[model samples]
Target chain A: MSNEQDSVSDILEDNTYKYGFTTDVESETFAKGLNEDVIRAISKKKEEPQFMLDFRLKAFAKWKTMKEPEWPNVHYPKIDFQNISYYSAPKQKKKLQSLDEVDPEVMRTFEKLGIPLDEQKKLANVAVDAVFDSVSVATTHKKKLMEVGIIFCPISEALKEYPELVEEYLGTVVPVGDNYYAALNSAVFTDGSFVYIPPDTISPMEISTYFRINTEETGQFERTLIICAENSYVSYLEGCTAPQFDTNQLHAAVVELVTMENAEIKYSTVQNWYAGDKETGKGGIYNFVTKRGKCQGDNSKISWTQVETGSAITWKYPSCILQGDNTTGEFYSVALTNGHMQADTGTKMIHLGKNTRSSIISKGISADYSSNSYRGQVKVGKNASNARNYSQCDSMLVGDKCSAHTFPYIETANSSVQVEHEAATSKISEEQLFYFESRGISRENAIEAVISGFCKEVFKQLPMEFAVEAQKLLTLKLEDSVG
Target chain B: MLEIKDLHAGFDGNEIVKGISLTINKGEIHAVMGPNGSGKSTLAKILSGHPSYEATSGEILFEGKNLLEMEAEKRSLAGIFMGFQYPVEVPGVNNAEFLRMAHNARRVSAGEEEIDPLDFDDLLSEKMKTLGMEKKYKERNLNDGFSGGEKKKNEILQMAILEPKLSILDETDSGLDIDALRVVAEGVNKLRTENNALILITHYQRLLDYIKPDFVHVLSNGKIVKSGDKALALELESQGYDWVTTAN
Candidate 1:
């Protein structure tokens, strides 16, 4: 078994990053660098409304006063903001009427990514909005979604077709001054998915988006906002990957979800960014994202489930703000880091209303020169009487060379509130490996089975198809680790 | 069914099994009895292709093939089964699922169709019944929180599921209570067939009273000092291991 594991590691060490190829689709790319003028150019290029331009200006001005945060447990070379192109778009000559009108090269890339854009074979009950680089290339199942009074489309298109709706809810949850990365995303985010489930109606299909960063020397900043009206329910999923490069690419995304009275929102992410070469860590994606959902009305619920396996350096925290009485919030995550990858991720649950409840389950796996950290906080305000929170963070270290850390903060002002936190760290025991191998399971399969067991709780929270995909994605990322 | 030729196995740098020769025919139960550190367990581990315990020299023949050349998983598919004394807990792997996978892996190797989950669950429940196990044991993580007796019973269940040609039980009776010992022995008794063989490595003659070995071998200082029929086990139990060690 040990010999089998060593051979796998050797093969992975000599292999290249699988998703590191370029797609030659003609795109309208902007000049590199950022400034007030560049921000204005992006706003004009999108043909934005005056209020939209004002929103960008306010976020850009706030972003200038902020410093890059260094408190996360991940380490990376300083990002030169001046070196990155702020905006890049796949140039479509005209409005595409159908899937065939889209660029075939980019379409083929999606096929390789296992996202069959063809409507007939598209994942059942899923409405997809494919975003390439800085713009949404196609939106599928739009008519069906529209018929049910649900609005699902690119945020770019939403700003034009329904500016009043976009203007009312854009920054209501995550304002421009939320964080360093959130401010930058609000200022320059080119495109992402927008979902609105109307009051009293459950969305017939899950809303999904496939985000790809194609152009080199460019930064991708996408903003996603999902609003569930009073007494409604919705499920949203986002998957991301980027072409590998020798230089680290910047990806700062902001996702905000708002649920009203008796409404529920389920959001999931499978992040598979390019994690540079195994040796030297010369290139990869610098993923610094801020995701937060607000349970604003009584009896509302918001749940976040993420499977993060890529990114050379990841510093993201998907959080929830319980602001209404009897609101419920949950965060389930599985973050795997291998081969020089570093991730600092978890979630925050803040309770401000009476009887609010939250639960967080995080599983972190580190293998082969990787470092994974889980940092989270749960706070109950003075008025939040009887608020409850339960948090569990389990870390699995695959090899001796990797590292895992956990940090938890809990604050309660009301004595009536309850908070329970449990954490455990373990190594993949040699005994377990030998046991599986002796039972006729190959070493690779043994490792995969162990990991899948470790992350089962989090995977159960994802949609059925995505749960399987997340498992397969985790196996692909941790294929090289062993005893 | 199995042959070991002057086996010279060791761990790290120290030689544990200096040199030993053994053979067993189908339908036979051979008891390898020894005091602590007599290399009985190490011999069982080596037969199952343990990564540690290098076979410094000598050869092992399973049926007609060189068993030493096969990987651990391949040897398992080749009908070798080892019941561990202290089976490690795999916290998230479902017990029934693990059994089905091992069963299918062997079936696939022999060009047989894999059993479906429904059929597997029914078959597993029937086997668990034979071992006096609850149906809920199938839903649990493999031996994650099992009692000592339960872990040993799980090994028996695995052996029953695989129905291997050769089985080496390494001190399986160490932690069993009287009741569990009876159940486990009964389970093993049901698995014996003319085409299969069993090697029971034990510290006492108590287990042989239930399962009944065809031959008894006394091991001292990594070598088999005496080989006899079942009567020798009762004699060793009454005389104590000191007599055997001193005699060698």
Candidate 2:
């Protein structure tokens, strides 16, 4: 078993990042810098309304007054903001009327990534908004979605068609100045998906967005907003990948969800950005994201399910604010870090109304020299009588070099609230692997079985198609980390 | 169908199994009884191809194939199974699903089509029923949160599912109650076939009473001091291992 472990570690040391190929397409990029002029240029480039510009200016002003947070349990060299290109997009001759008008090079790039945007190979039931670099290149099933009274398109298109709706709920959930990354995203976010499910209606099909970062030095700041009206339900998924570069790239994204009376929103993310060089950890995406949802009406629900298996460094906390009586909030996450990667991610559930409830299940798997942590908070306010919260965080360490940590905070001002938190740290033992082997299962299959079991609770929350893909993605990421 | 010659195995530069020679034929059940630290378990580990336990100098042949040269999983796929004394608890892995995986591994190795979940479920249900295991065992995690007796039963259930040609039961009867002991022994008895052999490593003669052994060997100080029929087990139980070790 020890010999096998040694060989496993050796293989992991040589594990390659697969999605590291850059697309060959002409791109229009901004000069490397950040300032008021850059914010104005970005807003102007999108041809936004005056209110949008005002929003960006406000966020930029707030961002100037704030500083990058360093409290997360990760370490990296200081980021020179002025050295990163704020925006980059593939050059487009004109607005695309259909997938046929998409550039062949960009289409081939997406096809290579297993996300075909062409009509002949589009995902059957998933309406995808494929964002290339800094702009959405194509949005499939828009006509079908519109017939069902559902609004699904890029945020830039939504701003042009329905500026009032965008203005009303853009930063309502996560404020413009909520955090450093959120503020930056608000100021320079190029393109992301916008979803609006009207009252008394469920989405006809699953809505998803595939984000691809091609340029080496450009920063990707995409914004996603979902609005579920009264008695409505919507499930949204997002997947991201980036080309490998020797210089680290920045990806600061913001996602907000608004659920009205009796509405439900399910948001899932499978982030597989290029995770630098396995041995040197030279280049990868710095994923800093802020995602939050608000249960604004009674009996509303919000669920967040995320699988983080990429990115060199990740600092994200998808949270929920239960502000309505009898509302529910749920979070399920599987964050895996390998080969010099570091991730500090979890959720926050704030119970602010009577009879509010929340459940959190987080599983972190760390391999090689990576670091994985689960930081979560559950807060019940004085008015939140009968509030309940249950949190369980488990970590699995693959080798002796990797590390895992859990930080859970629970605060309740009301005595009637009930909060339960359970945490456990486990290792993939040689004995366990031997047990599987003695039963005829190979070591690789043994590791996969154990990992899938560890992440079962979280994977079950994902949509059917995504659950299978997520399982494969996890196996691919941890392929050589263990025997 | 299994042969071990002068197997001197140990871990961390310390030889625990000084020298063991044994041959098991089809339809034969061999019982090895010894006190603590007598290397009974080490022999089982060496046979199972555990990496930590190195065979300093030995030869193990299973079906005329060099077993020491094969990886643990390859050894298993070649019709060798080991029932661990302490079954590992794999949380969230469904027991039925795990059984199917192991069974499918063998099937694939033998160039057969994998059995679907529905058919596998029926087969597993029948096996569990024969072992007196409750239906909940199918849905529960593999050996996770299972009691001592339940863990032992799960090992046997896996053995029943895989149906390996040679099974080395390393203290499968340990920590089992009387009722559980009977169920386990009956389960083993039903699995016995002319094409398969069983090696039961035990520290007590009590297990021998339930499932009679064709050959009983008394091991002391890493060497088999006495070898005989089932009567030797009764003699050892009555006179204890003191007489055999003293005479040797």
**Which candidate comes out best when scored by TM-score?**
1
In TM-score terms, candidate 2 sits at 0.94
lDDT of 1 by residue, A7-115 (tens): 7667576445567788998888888889989989988988889998899999999999999898999887778899999888877767788888888898888888878
Off by more than 4 A, model 2: A1-15, B177-179, B220-226, B235-248
lDDT of 2 by residue, A103-145 (tens): 8999998888888887789888999999998999988888899
Please identify model 1 stretches exceeding 4 Å from their true place: A1-17, A119-121, B177-179, B235-248
lDDT of candidate model 2 versus the reference = 0.91
Model 1, chain B only, scores a TM-score of 0.97
> Which candidate leads the pack in DockQ?
2
